[model samples]
Target: MPSPDRSSDAVTPFHLNVPEEELDDLRDRLSRTRWPERETVSGWKQGVPLDRARALVAYWEDGYDWRRCEAALNGIGQFTTTIDGLNLHFLHRRSPEPDALPIVITHGWPGSVVEFMKVIGPLTDPVAHGGKAEDAFHVVCPSLPGYGFSQRPKEGWPVPRIASAWIALMKRLGYARFVAQGGDWGSAVTTAIGASGDPAVAGIHLNMLVVRPTAEDLADATDQEKASLESLQRYMQDGNGYSQQQATRPQTLGYGLVDSPVGQAMWIYEKFREWSDCGGEPENALSRDEMLDDIMLYWLTGTGASSGRLYWESFRAFGSDKVMVPTGYSMFPKEIFRASRRWAERQYPNIIHWNELERGGHFAAFEQPELFVEEVRTAFRTLRTS
Candidate 1:
């Protein structure tokens, strides 16, 4: 284990060991769930379907094995380090290849470090995963402050602060030069880090590119740009309710999420159905185990409120600045917001790679790990020369 940085606080090795009693309690709660009348409309229009919610809860109570998830996390080398008065939890898996590049992979709202579990092996130990040793990366996946195992911030810790903390984390780990990759809010933080003019941040890769266009930019938009704008507008109209609730009143929402396991599950599960490339059901995109494993991260840690608080801090604050570093973007077809190459280039002047992927959605890594790994590898391959 790496020793603590005495100047700040110790970088203590951490493990996942939720108590048996908590698991029992969760099961009991699921068993005693108070039912609500089914939605009048068909499908997921109103929310997670009543039948789907009940079925998922039943499996969560009887079939889910949190211990397996815990062991998998522990197996990947978990640790906590105090950064800016918060104990930040992260998975630090150094590549076996000495020359591998250091890269920090960040997750956004409704996601934890578990998002990168499948890609970790391929990135950190490429040879073991049927890749060349030269393609390896020292992968670091941190739970954003106030999410997962990380301690909640007493005050606001927005995207810029989170970016700074990430840089500090990389430096503390003896990485003088590193790259960053993220999607969703992770994209915001990575963009901030790239734009901060930190020489340590060699480059960044983003799956979600949030761009703001001026009136003139919108007036002369291409077909793709116009379509992208329309999609965003639709989302702002119909899909933004949860965002608005979380940003304005996360505390009120948290009560239900924290108190009812079914509530928390449905809150996230709805996003999986809506945001994923799964035609109608999220099961088409991720396995039942995969979805439940992610939910357990929130439920076990009781971070329902704290996790939603990130939106409160930075939801309305996207694309405030331009990123000048060598940047790469992978635009998944089903992402909530898609930026055309021209629009993206306006914001990211030094974009080296931009690809519109055919599959995947917001949770790119979790939904399509193989494609996600390829995208990451391809995005940073040239930057590795630095």
Candidate 2:
């Protein structure tokens, strides 16, 4: 396919045709990975264990098929359009129900639109999935500007900027009034969209709610708030090295990630395990094939550095004013930072729905798609009536 023309608002049809050489090179690299010594202690204290790494790498070379994922994306109706001088690739699947609400879903680092595959069909066509017509959504999942199939940025593209692009994107797609939803970095952008008070947006929803609790709120914290605080502290201390590196020197770290298929797999695989409530057993959360498919997006696109640059561009500056629009939040127990309703209310004053789920984690849609869909449909149900 010709490279996407970047000068116009044309939404061009797109297809994936991974050359045979790319897969051949990936297999060769996976086969030749220089083995690392086993951890000094045990059970993921140092990082991904040597044995686990070997198992995944072995399967990545022999068991995973990238063609299946390519076909799935194409079947979902992928397209590319220029927004803010960048070409964005997105999956757009309209519901059979014409009145279905249009919703844009965003993905975060180490994740691509591939993460939402399990929930898209169920969401876009609720009747086929045993849901009422009123619950249907015209789903749009974008590969974040510097991630997945979207084009890389030449300069800073922060959260507010991305949120603006998404607003324009939805309007360009004929959605005059729609809701927004996201998690991870997507949560930041979605929140910014609501904060923009974009007249076209009806409201917003987030599985991961990021909020800063003030001293006054902390003084009157509940048990749930205390637990949330503990989780946040742990992440600040132990789980944020990757964020720091990405925010500071992504290009320096990209060489190994882009060069070694095994390196890229483990970097993301570790997060999938640690964040998805499957602490010691990653395959318990996602099959090696599923994990490898997400890895291939990073590997084939060679976007390891470009994707991380979003962190460098917006990490410290990723916050929003109080969102006055009707908001909905689902707090997953295993998420890196589980904000209490009161804490979230500081940023989102008009919360219409709040549910503290007993299961799932950061990759909510990928790990627990059924629950994720339920939360989304229920959260937006009230907004639809208005």
- Give all TM-scores, in the order shown: 0.97, 0.98
lDDT of each: 0.90, 0.89
> What is the number of backbone collisions in each predicted candidate, taken in the order shown?
0, 0
Query: Per-residue lDDT of 308-378 in model 1, one digit per residue for the tens?
Result: 88888888886467888999999898999998777778789999888888999999999999999888888
Write down the RMSD of all candidates, one decimal each. 1.9, 1.1
Candidate 2 whole-model C-alpha lDDT, 0 to 1: 0.89
lDDT of 1 at 149: 87
- Local error of candidate 2 at residue 278 (angstroms): 1.5
Off by over 4 Å in 1: 1-7
